[model samples]
Target: MRVKSEIWIRAYLRRCQAEGVPAVVVRRGDEAAGAIFICVDRLDGSVALYGPAPAGIEGGETERRWVACFKTATASGAEVSAYLARQSRFDSDLWIIEIEDKQGRHFLGEDAIIE
Candidate 1:
């Protein structure tokens, strides 16, 4: 059984808050199973995006390897925005979270595959 999208998002936000990282939900999607996309603003005039992996890629893997966690090399705001806009168009129900951190800490915890 998977955790509902909204519940997972709320928990993520709380975890960020506890760690003193500024995080915000840029866009909200369906409460049930919408895919989550995180935008990390490095605060150095650059941003990067991350999203979950497909079922085929993550299935049968450990929780730590569930998400593909692809990262865009830090780029200009316009470039990041353009990429995100394209994604938003393709998935209207996608949830977008923006995290402002100088070190690019996404607070993904231990259950993420950061590659």
Candidate 2:
């Protein structure tokens, strides 16, 4: 179980809030978490949503919840696509959505669909 460093999480949250997305931190199993979770960000010149490969992603409550947090950050409409697509290394089962997160706040907007 790999928990995101406090520095990283805080920075991420700050950045998201600054962008008006207001980065949210939720425990992995928290009901608030969506089914497909992601850790959203931008690497280089594009957007990215990352998560630990689900292959053997297992652990206790704390671990599981953090993992969930990681995933939710990148899920649909969370706005982390192009950066992930640019990754030269990634898992096959990893759902790299094509839609980018834009300024539209509509529920299930065009960017909400999984790719």
Candidate 3:
């Protein structure tokens, strides 16, 4: 079975803190099963957004996969905000996590497949 959304998010926050990265949950969603979106602020003018990958990508059913939300490697803050607004309207149960790292580290590891 898959891990609950709340449990996964708490663990992820701990991991980020351990790595010395400042991360915070901007918006809280369902505790059971909610889509997660991550925003990596580069501390510059650009940002990177990652959302849950489509099913049957590569990871197992119990694993959470992510994909870049933009065509380019990074996008403007305004652009990211607009995309996230649309997403929030579509899925109110989606969680939003923002990480402030000058290196633009998302810490997604092998679970992320940039497209």
* Each prediction's whole-model lDDT (CA): 0.75, 0.35, 0.93
Of the pair 2 and 3, which is ahead by lDDT? Answer: 3
Clashing pairs in 1: none
User: Predictions ranked by lDDT, top down?
Assistant: 3, 1, 2
For candidate 2, report its TM-score.
0.28
Cα lDDT tens digits, model 2, 52-114, are 334433442234322222233333433334434443234232322222235422122232333
User: In candidate 1, what are the lDDT values of residues 1-115, reduced to their tens digit?
Assistant: 5777899899989998998889999899989877788778888897766777666554324232234333446667787678778877998998988999899887776555556
Taking the tens digit of each residue's C-alpha lDDT, what string does model 3 give over 17-109? 999999999999999999999999998989999999998876548899999999898999999999999999999999999999999899989
Q: Candidates' TM-scores? A: 0.83, 0.28, 0.96
- The weakest ten consecutive residues by lDDT in model 1 span 59-68
Compare the candidates by lDDT and give the number of the best one: 3
Model 1 misses residue 87 by how many Å?
1.2
Better of 2 and 3 by TM-score: 3
Misplaced by over 4 Å in model 2 are: 1-4, 28-49, 52-115
What is the TM-score ranking, best to worst?
Answer: 3, 1, 2
